[model samples]
Target: MHETLEIRLTVNERSEAVRIEPRETLADVLRERLSLTGTKVSCDAQVCGACTVLVDDLAMSGCTFLAADADGRSVRTVEGLARDGRLSPVQQAFIDHAAFQCGFCTPGMLMAATAILEEHPRPSRDQVVHGLEGNLCRCTGYEPIIEAVLAAADAGTVDEGVAGW
Candidate 1:
């Protein structure tokens, strides 16, 4: 039998205690065990940023990140981007700016953008570009995505009371 570890973690604001193998990746636990499939796994090497998720409000690649490391930490997925049925400002900005196609990279891109906004609420255009460099969009939809991020910043949507994210 594979040695397992019992870990307590908060995901999407819900608390859960789960048994997992030490070798398992956060993406595997989130997708397989927690049924949070919004965090897509691609390139599995932490290069594509497709499996990006937030651990303690910091963006990380779930695919390569160990699940055990997330113990006692807060994990946020793309699904958490909506609150009370309203999309987070970054997600809404993605739609308003038509920043997604094929929808593969959107989740990672959104999480990354959320991290950016959390750090720099009013980042410049170049800053947005640099922040998203780790994420790869196979749909080649960068312009609108960039515009959406910029618009979200311009609208000043990342205040504490405004977004529970």
Candidate 2:
């Protein structure tokens, strides 16, 4: 029988305490336990970036990250991108630019873009490309995504209303 470990963490600005198996990944805890399914799981080896989530404001692969490792940390999933009822700048930019096709990679892409904007508020085209290189999208051909990020930056919405977590 596997032992369950008690962990306390913050998700989407809400505090949570959960009993999870030590071997459980952050993706499993977020999706199955916490009911936050916005974090997708693809290429579980962390190569696809489909499971990207923000831990302490940095992009991390949820599928490869242990839930226990999230104890005392703040995790932000795609579902948390919007606050109140307004869409985040990145989300809006993606929509305005038609950055996604199948939408399977949208969540990770959004998180990655958010992280990039946070790190480099005015990232150049090459910087945006480099920042999002970890995420793989079969649709949109990457141009729309880059454009969306740039748009978000240009609109000055990338950092607006976003907490420092």
Candidate 3:
């Protein structure tokens, strides 16, 4: 029998009811089902933060999170970070600092940074590095990314509504 699982999920502050396969990953559901393509999938094994998404308030690897596990929970992808077409401060800082290139890692980087800033608010350089340890960016060097994060923290310019920080 073809089983259709009904799952209710919150994305970008909007609730959705979806049917997914038992084995489908959260990333799959986000991208294919919900069309939230901002969440990328690199290494599906959870080592790479490329598929990172906020599950509740914790950063999680969406590739490993089952769609069923995410049911009725809030999931935030990079797409959800912007409000009314305005980018969040961290996101704007990223753009202002030119922290990304090639862009494969941007989504995960943003998610990781969001989690970092939320936890630390004003994290040390090492803490920033440690927070983003799992995320890998092959295009831009680390300096720009670090600078961007520091700038966002220093400015205290984060849109509280966007990140809830």
lDDT (Cα atoms) of all candidates against the true structure: 0.91, 0.91, 0.88
lDDT of 2: 0.91
Q: Kindly indicate the candidate among 2 and 3 with the higher TM-score.
A: 2
Clashing pairs in 1: none
- Residue-wise lDDT of candidate 1 within 1-165, one digit each (tens)? 999999999999999999999999999999999999999998998899999999999999999999999999999999998888978888988999889989999999999999999899889999999999999997756999999999888665545576445
**Which ten-residue region of model 1 has the weakest summed lDDT?**
156-165
CA lDDT, candidate 1, residue 14: 97
Q: How many pairs of residues in model 2 come into backbone collision?
A: 0
Local distance difference test, candidate 3: 0.88
TM-score of candidate 1 against the unseen true structure: 0.95
In model 2, the runs with Cα more than 4 Å from the true position are 157-165
lDDT of 3 by residue, 1-165 (tens): 787799998987899999888999999999998888999999999987999999896899999999999899998899988777877778988999999999888999999998898888888999999989899998787789999999888766444444453
| Clashes per candidate, residues 3 or more apart or on different chains | 0, 0, 0
Candidate 3 off by > 4 Å: 157-165
- What TM-score, computed on C-alpha atoms, does each candidate reach? 0.95, 0.94, 0.93
